[model samples]
Target: MNHAQIRAFHAVASEGSFTKAADVLNVTQPTLSGQVAALEEIYGVKLFERRGRGIEITEIGRRLHAVTLRQFAVELEAEQVLLSARGLMSGQLRVAADAPYHVVPLLATFSRLYPGINFSMSFGNSQQVLQGLFERKSDVVVMPNIHEDRRLHAAPLKREPLIVFVDRNHPWAARRSISITELPHHRIILREKGSVTRKIFETALESAGVKLTDILEIGSREAVREAVASGLGIGVVFESEFGNDTRLHGLTVRDVQLEGLEYVACLKDQKNSPVIRAFFDQIQSSTATNLS
Candidate 1:
């Protein structure tokens, strides 16, 4: 099938509604339907089944969609390669990041350095970022906790200490330090599962046999900070990630001494393109400066 037909099939399958897909493709519903129909006829398999106003993608359609997404990525990369060969500096960099604290700074630096390169960035929980890396959806990932995988390469970026954050009016606000055993009585705010900070806190708590009494699960670090500031719960996060706000107070960043509890940079099989290598070097140099 033609690329347009393949794209139409992918869009329809992804949107799960002909009308929605047409809107996304900026084409009429009839045209989108015709393209999808043509693709199905060529493949000799029904791609989707009607389900109310929406549609359910068939197994064959699911497979095709996955391949087409990768094919599209490869085609884009090929174009970039051609441009580079013509002495033009251009490429797209896709990165999956778990936390805004780490991502925002790095992206700011990269943007200043490589204004010509386009970037596609996604924010997700640590698990989602890792999955994106495995699926080849992202060229690189920044995550807190990393799992061992043979197909991946990882580098430690920094080691940050975890701290207890409390509302300014809370009794703990005046305290210099609090024991880990005292944590269970306070309402604790935590990031969602797959967060490096959450995993580290959970593992430490488990090891100390201290189960939290009240827990609030939040998706964003900013949300967690706000919740803690509003006295909903005390939050556990990296000290470096905490913004300077008057409403929030923090205790000493100690008690749970974690090793390698920092943002880790990961890539698949070290497939270091020139852009990727340059970005990596820039980050490394920045990290060195920060440490010094």
Candidate 2:
């Protein structure tokens, strides 16, 4: 097996861009391309379909990428073992997260503890970040409400209730809380369908028998915040994430129990690796601090 070529292919497949893969591997783009091309030529099979200004991994390429993900994870474990033996920690640590609010502090702690480690984060909805974690594109993920799976290990970070928000000029701005039934009276701004917060909110609305007809589906929390601030609609967000904004007011939900329960999760097999363990330790300690 051509180890260098496989590494080149894995980099491109994971990043979905040759330029990024080259930068990641510290190789010239042409050199990276040459490695992939040589691999394809040797196998007499085209692994990628080149479209103008982009490329898609073919079915074969995806299968090979799956194998490489496992292969690289093992390589990561081996490397971690060596680094631990030398009493030094260095190398890239990739994190995927649904939001920046909770993960940022943990990252700050880890950065302080392991200044030699390189860090990268990719953000998405919970499902997307979880998928990235399973793909090995990221070593760990900050997720909300991930299901139990034997293949994974999760460290509880937080569980906070969702709150309603309105612009300062809205009629309910002075109110400290509102019942779920009140949601039907106002236009609401919601996250996309895939959002775990939206799912939990919807479930709460259903349980309360509140049917909100006037709803706007926005793609991100910031967009929902902007919409609410512009007086487009009232918005909902986890209490922990609803930072103090002068233009908006957060009201506790009176009856419904919609909350975001987040975790720092990684593959069960990789949990013992030094960098991942360091991360889980910091987050767990942070959680303990919050509880205390």
Candidate 3:
């Protein structure tokens, strides 16, 4: 196996750009591209399709990336093991989350406590973020823990209720709560499918026999908020994530309870890793200090 070629391919695959991959690997773009091209040439397979000013991984490339994810993860573990002897001082961890509100606080706490440690975060819907965890793209993830899975070491972080909101001048602005029955009257803006908040909201609507007539589906929280703020429609989100947006007014879905359990989780196999364990412990310690 050509380790250098595989590393080059993995960098490009993960970073999604030749420029980014080269910068991360500290190599010239030509050198990195040559390494990947050589790998394909020697293997007699097409790995990436050149798009205009970009590239797309082929089916075989994705399959190979899956294998490389595990291969490099073990390599990272080995490196972490060697570095642990230096008092767990220097390390990098990748973190993903379905939403930023819950995980961002934990990250802030972790950063304050472990100044030497470096971390990166990416956000997506619940499904996308969890996929990143399982695919080894992230060492840990923060997301809703609604499903049971033995493959993860999940620590419950918080339970926050979902709320609906609208532009400040909307008819419901003065109200503190809304019923599922009342939602269908105005256009309802929601996160795209796979969002925990949207899932809970939709499930409740289904149970309540509330079928929304006018719907505007958006792909992210900030976008949905902006859509609502622009008077396009009503938007639903976690109470904690509502923030202090003066352009909007938040109203609880008081008729039926809608909440999500935030959890900081790592693969069960990786819970014992030094940085992952430290993160888990830090959250527990932070929770304890808060309760005390």
Scored by TM-score, the top model is 2
Residue range 1-292, candidate 2, lDDT tens digits: 8999999998898778898789778899999999999999999999899999999999999999889888888987887788888655576689989889888878887888888889998999887888777667799998788879966999787777888899999999889998888788889999988888899899998888889989999999999999999999999898878888899999998786778678889987578687887788777656875543
Where does model 1 exceed 4 Å of error?
1-88, 258-260, 264-266, 287-292
- lDDT computed for candidate 2: 0.86
Quote model 2's TM-score: 0.73
How well does candidate 3 match the true structure in TM-score terms?
Answer: 0.70
Q: Write the per-residue lDDT of candidate 3 for residues 1-292, one digit (tens) a residue.
A: 8999999998888767888789777899999999999999999999899999999999999999888878877876886678777867888889998877778888898898888999999999999998777666799998885477866788877777888899999988888887888988889998888888889888889888889999999988889989999999999888888999999999888788787777788876577688998899888855544333
Better of 1 and 3 by lDDT: 3
Report the Cα RMSD per candidate.
Answer: 6.3, 5.5, 6.5
Q: Tell me which of candidates 1 and 2 scores higher on lDDT.
A: 2
Cα lDDT of model 1 by residue, 1-292, tens digit: 4989998987776556788778767899999999989988887899999777768898888898889767765765775576657543677788888767777778788888878788888988788888776555778888765767655666657667778889999998888788888988888999988777888888888887889878999988889988988889899877777778999887863566643344446553334465665567767765665433
Candidate 1: pairs in clash = none
Clashing pairs in 2: none
Decreasing TM-score order of the candidates: 2, 3, 1
Task: Single out the weakest 10-residue window by summed lDDT for candidate 3.
Answer: 283-292
True lDDT of residue 123, candidate 3: 91
Give candidate 2 misplaced runs (Cα > 4 Å): 1-80, 289-292
TM-scores vs. true structure, each candidate: 0.66, 0.73, 0.70
Show where candidate 3 strays beyond 4 Å: 1-85, 286-292
lDDT of 3 at 60: 98
